[model samples]
Target: MRKDVVPVSSPSPLPPLSPPAGPPPCPPARRVSLPAARPVRLVLCLSPVLLAGCWALADRPVASEGASRLAAADPGWLLAGAALTCLTWVAAACVRQGSLPDKLPPGLLLASQFAAGAANHVLPGGLGAHAVTLRFLRARGVPLDRATASIGLYSLARSVTRTLVLLAFLAACPARRRLGELVPDGPVPVPAAAVAGGALAVAGVLLTVVPPVRRPVTGLVRAALADARAVHGRPCRVLALWGGSAAMPLVQAGTLVCVGTSLGLGLPWEQVVLAHLAAGTAVGAVPAPGGLAVDAALVWTLVSFGAVPAVAAATVIGHRVLNDWLPLLPGALTLSALIRARAL
Candidate 1:
């Protein structure tokens, strides 16, 4: 008995699955938690403050004395010294630009130098400043070799100029006789020179023995020579290099002179200049950072020149405040800003 089977149509085949309307929803964006990122940024932001604070606290007594003396100093002369201090950075920028054949943005170059001054005080042997400059050059697309060569040239020119300046002042200074008294009657200088020569010789031998070291050093020498030739060929660059270098010591002396005058330090401006130049030259070979050794030498020299001990101390302190301490915070801020902008 065939049951009246109603024509049972097979269930309509399901419509073919169509692809979801858009590209497969990207796997829920991975939530990457950088636990250290915030802390890194915080550290970077606070580094300058911490450094300045620690430096100030390290010499709290000296800093306090300097601050009090500066407060008592002639504001007009202090202002002049401050102005001269600013010019030193300008001179530095010119020297840096003249060292390289390529042109750096004047504003940024000046800014970098301003920032470098702050860094110079923090690290030994000017490492901090050099590091900042190297980073700046790299960011500006300068070749590493050329950048390094420029630094070497800058240092060499500055040293030569400083020596020439010291000699010139010595020849012209009326206090030359007094300065001669400061030199020890011994073979001290001879040994120092011999040691320096031996160090160079040992370094040369090591470079010669190590292929890897030799190659890079040789390349650097070649690059330096080429850059020097290129830079010297241009009259403006030559003037800027030598002239700016020479100006550095002169301006620094001027700053000291102004500060000394402001604080009633009993010394002629010329004597002060001579003292500063001589003291710096004498102690420059010392590796103490931030010219600490030079500062001590300067204080001693000033005393020898018949300045009152307290006044001489105050003078040096004021000079340091005008040159180093005053600009530190601003320079640090500039440095931080540059880092943020990726210009350093």
Candidate 2:
């Protein structure tokens, strides 16, 4: 009986179950670290002005001379030159868009090209601009290969169009004989062409023989060809590509003509245009940033065209001011805005 009672005694109360541990009260959501946009924008806004001031100070003599010349130039013609300069960027944007099938925001596309002008001056062979564009395309979800192909297509189209334009101008221009004189008659070109061709052949042979190199290169070529076909298939793209390419050189030439007129250069507009096209086509292969060699070539060509050296120099200075210096600050600002907005 006693044993049964003992056994019957209520089992010791079970230890109070500890509350099941929860995910350590989920540590207060960590705030995502992000760049402060306001400070970045402020810096972006100020940096260009500061840099421009420094640039002016560093070359004060040239800046002062340029300023005086610009002040003396005809404002009307100068304004026209500025307008033409702006159109060049628009044409560039068109070519860029035409290179890819994916639709990009028109506003941003224009802005990017404007920004690209500044970048183009900083790096040799337009690498800075291409880098900006590549980043932009990547941000917009374009595949790396496709984006790269687009750049190649754009460059190819531009070069081909430029050459065609040059030929056309040469045939139509009354000054073709003079331009022909500018080309030094030598065996240098033949050797250069042979070297280039041999290099290409070597590269091709390597690509064909090496499996590791062959596969990626072949794939890239296929992709590029496919994109090119796709781009050409659309009428709008074709127009934008070829039309923009054609328009860019013309617009640029027009700018030079306007600058020449403003400075009272003796050469006719037609001659000025011809000289610009010739100089650009000739020196374009040189890897000088911001077309330094092209500038020198242009001045030389203009002087040969019977322009007064002083006037030609002044004209070139004005053209550079309108085409390059004026836009640089704004372009840098646009680039900064794009970066801040993550559009690039």
Candidate 3:
């Protein structure tokens, strides 16, 4: 009846209907890219800063004398430094093997160490070397937990020994005692003991809070206690291995002192120990490859605090040339050989 009353207007043109809107869509998640290796670029960025720092510190008249002293350093000292590095490797292997099974073999340990050292020098934070060591041990059928425990134990043993040496030196020296007082109740009186206690406390906290660290810490504790038991049975081997590892840092400190002497700067043994330990620790914590720029700055700063700026600069410079760069050659060669031999 309605259709009869209305003119057929194309089915009365259906009223416009709006499509229902769904919930607003979320933004797509962004992806992050991994960092790329750029060794040459990193070196370029760091080298200029190192050179400038050295130059700025070398401005004093004392620099001339330091230059002369550097020229006259006994070649014997250089030989001794190299020997110390060798001893370090041997001690490292011994420590590694001590925590591992008897069937793992010493050769693999040494190869792993050499490879790791090379990686440390070339890569940031020496993580590359650490990774290599981890993978190598893993390939040898070492469980991750055991490998982690062994590495931690060896490192802890070395650090404890080195810290004790520095503490002894600090206690024996008056200048260091005075310097310690200057920093508003600083680590002045007993640097080593204080640092060790601090490290233990920090590690204890880390074990309690961090899941990754907890497992490793517990494993390490067990391994170390077991090692203590074994040492009680064969105290000689443990002592020799750890003792040798511990001595390596002393050799390093002695070398730094010799460098100071060669620069005609009578930096005390205590100060020298302070410089080496402080600088080495700081640099090792940095992410830079072998802490190139950071290490140089740290060494310069430590020595300068106790000596003429010129002498400090010269000492750092000469030490780098004599110690750091000199070792790089052999380390590089060893790395190449290991690579070619497929030992790494």
Candidate 4:
């Protein structure tokens, strides 16, 4: 019997199917120890308390003296001075804004200025504030060249405007024209020339000696000039930059004037204001951070104008306590917050 040839179609072998790769073995988890992060967290939590405790222990005597002086002072005038002091923050914020082309969070900007006052007291020559602002704008994505240029503009405008304001006040107010009384009775020209010449020589020597910094110096010069041109192109920016700078000194002096009056400082009002301007100008180049030089200068100037020494000291102390000392802690905390947010 011939078996019919049967074609057996072997079932086609099934194509191999593989399961989806499970997340490629998740390269071993980073073994982050909680201990590593705790110390930082702990420090952040405790810094304020420690700072306050140290300040309290150190400043009790000064605080007592200041409190006594303020207690006896005219509350109305002191209050007005404080109110004006607050306005100075607003003015500072305005100046900072004018320095940058990009708009920043207004609340943060205002807070920065307030915080900057603390920095001014802590660091020499406004370096602390400058550092904070530079960092802030950099975080905001501003170009380094432009941010640096803004700083230059702010500084130049502040110095130049201050001088202009001082001159204008002396010219318009004949009462203040007696600013010559500030100098001792001698030929001022010789000493003045000597000082100027000495300063110029020192600056020239430094620039000549430091060749490496010249590259940045050159770039900064160009950037500053460019920013100046850009600012002039916008009238609002011009006003904010110059106007805010111009008003800053006046408001600051006004605080001193108010404090002096509250404590019965016996000088013409213009004389008090002029005294503040003159003293600040004199010690401005000194690296005395905060108001150390300035406070002494104010006290001396008031004494020269026939105010009682104790009373003058009290006024200076009171003003310092209000503007510089009181706000430090909160300002520091604000600075810390900004830093954490990467806005500083």
Candidate 5:
């Protein structure tokens, strides 16, 4: 009908918006069952009882006497001994730091070491500190297996170095005698010492050799020969670590000598070193916190072998005060810092 052609502009179709993906599947919503709350209630009720027992132990006659004596020990000797211990820990930290692929900060690692040491003194069983150290390393991305292997290797290296140093000391003073009175006719043979030395040698050799372990054991041997070349591939650093580790025992033995001299026990350095090593090794097997009972027993046994009764007791007591308690304050503080920092 001749209507004028009109142009119709239809509206453009709108694009549909898809719904946003839901919260990434909610991660399967792991169901975590926390520990029952009963133990917390029990602890709240019994805490006072536990504290009372601690007080009782602290109030014991022997504990009181020891505390008094510890308070009265020479400040200089205590400071010097503490300094040596700090040096030992530093060496340990250095070795650990050197072994890592991504080396941890030196300060943090040292803090962890000190914290671990403090824990070793307070916690039951010998592995407390080591466990803390492993956890610390694990948190920092070191695989558990590798961390354990590294720590074990470092400990072995330290022990080997210590043994070698002790042996060298013995060799240098072969004629040394115990604290017992001189025999009118001749010296009594110390069969016990000889047996101990022989046993140590055998155990050390067996542990160092053998297959499967032969790999790591071989590493130790090559490291020793090339001076840690096989381990870190840097002989000088490895040798330095070993040498530093050896110095710890030497300084420790020297502390014993100082104790003997101060207490007028007149115990020979060689005799003391032998006894010290034996006692240290034996007591280390004990599970008590810091090997407290074990350490006391070791000192008593070592000193009693030849020392005059009173002097021996005094030396033992004095050594504990000078060596153990004095550094505990700083060690504990360091440990606390580590925990607070979550470095260990």
Candidate 6:
């Protein structure tokens, strides 16, 4: 026992562990690219509005005329007009959101609407905006069929509301009835209408003949109708859909009033509103990009309302600069950004 104890002295304590080779060089101080990205991001952020302004100024006489009128414009009235113009965009956004069943981020929804304004100018019949919005809704994870349905519902609602609002105004202001006589006596061309109908019929026949086109179209129509019914079932959606649509034309009319006032066009306010609504309804369906026909009709309508020819021309031209052309640049910019972000 004594021999065993002498041989088996307790194991000596182990030495302490040392720091790992100078802390492994402190992980090479990772470089952050945040600063580099900042200025680029800032430029991108500002480019849209700047682009919009520059593009607006590029339109030779329209931009120059608008600027001239703005310079002499009663600051108060011009400010009001600007405010109303801004609200029209908001209304458009609200309608879009309301039409969708899936919840959308308000900011993005608003952005899509802002972008849509430019697209309307690019394609006749609002094809560009419709295309953008359809893509946007799909990006938001809405089913393709429902998105299509919602867009259809939105357009239908807008067209109907415009008519209803016009009717309401006509009911309220009987004096505006006299202006209806200004509608030209020229008959619509039967041959043109017949040709358009023939083309549509041929297209329909082709759709029926082509399985690829027919299947998806049939499914889309069914899905869309179902979604539309679902949307109509919700009262809040209904209100937003129709209410926002109804307010838009009124705001547009208000924009015209402000423009007229700026140009010293001495006309009855109600008459001006009536004239705009009437002209819009008359020429809105024609496939003219930027509504050349609508612009002409508006000028003619104003002249019929006893506005001087020069004043009528100037007013329509100025409002076109504001309502249509002004939004194009910013809208295109927004569209580009949205595409990059995968939101369109």
**How do all models score by TM-score?**
0.89, 0.86, 0.61, 0.81, 0.64, 0.78
How well is each residue in 1-344 modelled by candidate 5, as lDDT tens digits?
79898999999999899879786555667788668765775564444335434533664664466566546556666566556666766776776754544457777887777656655654666475678688888878876556776667667766777677656655675433442222234433477578789998986777767566657666545544442334467665565466656666777767766666655666676777766765665456567764566567655656556677666666666666556555555666665555455565
**Which candidate comes out best when scored by TM-score?**
1
Say which prediction, candidate 2 or candidate 4, comes out ahead on lDDT: 2
How do the residues 217-238 of candidate 4 rate in per-residue lDDT, one tens digit apiece? 7787788787778777887888
Q: How high is the CA lDDT of each candidate model?
A: 0.90, 0.85, 0.62, 0.79, 0.62, 0.81
Model 4, residue 201: C-alpha shift (Å): 5.9
- The residue ranges of model 1 lying beyond 4 angstroms of the native Cα positions read 1-35
Model 1 lDDT per residue over 116-136, tens place: 987877887777788889989
Clashing pairs in 1: none
lDDT of 6 at 280: 93
Give me the overall lDDT of model 3: 0.62
- Residues 1-344, candidate 6, lDDT per residue (tens digit)? 46555566899999998877764555667777888887776676555556556555555677687667667767777677778888998898878876776678889988998888877665788787788889898898888788898898889889999999888878886667577577456665676689899999998998989999898888888987787777688988788888999988999999999989988899878888988999899888889776788989999888877889988888888788777776677677887788668787
Task: In candidate 6, list every pair of residues with a backbone clash.
Answer: none
lDDT of 1 at 280: 85
Ten-residue stretch with the least lDDT total in model 1 = 41-50
Q: Every model's Cα RMSD, please?
A: 6.3, 3.8, 12.9, 5.3, 8.4, 7.8
Off by over 4 Å in 4: 1-35, 41-56, 174-181, 184-211
> Best by lDDT, which number?
1
Check candidate 5 and list the clashing pairs.
223-228
